[model samples]
Target: MPQMAPLYWLYLFIFFLLTLLLFFMVNYFIKPFDNISSVSHDTKIIYKSWKL
Candidate 1:
């Protein structure tokens, strides 16, 4: 059991790292779409302001 401790810890660390990587990847992919939608909304607002 003592010999397995390090391997167990390593697995836990790797799992944590993988979770963080996936979280970042999800956020990274989502942000671009959010930004694009916001940009379009902003452009529409600007056009409306110009019309007013």
Candidate 2:
């Protein structure tokens, strides 16, 4: 029925959060962006300022 010290819990919580963040950064963002869109259609940009 005893409680923990405030600083102890705070430090542990912060450490756990930083560990989780590092795990995610090592998992997801360390890879290149994969091109999932397989569309081969042509895309054009027309200048509206030159149009009559």
Candidate 3:
């Protein structure tokens, strides 16, 4: 098998880092929406308790 060059390894590393960054960015954006939905659901439950 042919050995890969150092530049190719650098490119791979950069690609991996970018992939990780993109994953975190998506997670960050999504996490707030999830939290908001959960918070709203919890508040509904709390309101029901207050009415009881």
Candidate with the greatest lDDT versus the true structure = 1
Candidate 1 local lDDT, 1-52, one digit each (tens): 7999999999999999999999999987776666667867776644455664
Question: Please, what is the TM-score per model?
Answer: 0.62, 0.48, 0.57
For the record, the alpha-carbon RMSD of candidate 2 to the native fold, in angstroms, is 5.6
- Give model 3's TM-score versus the native structure: 0.57
What value does the lDDT take at residue 39 in candidate 2? 33
**Models sorted by TM-score, best on top:** 1, 3, 2
User: Candidate 1 local accuracy as lDDT?
Assistant: 0.84
What lDDT score is found at residue 17 in candidate 1? 100
For 1-52, candidate 2 gives per-residue lDDT tens digits of 2356877889999999999999998978666444333233234445689778
lDDT-sorted candidate list, best first: 1, 3, 2
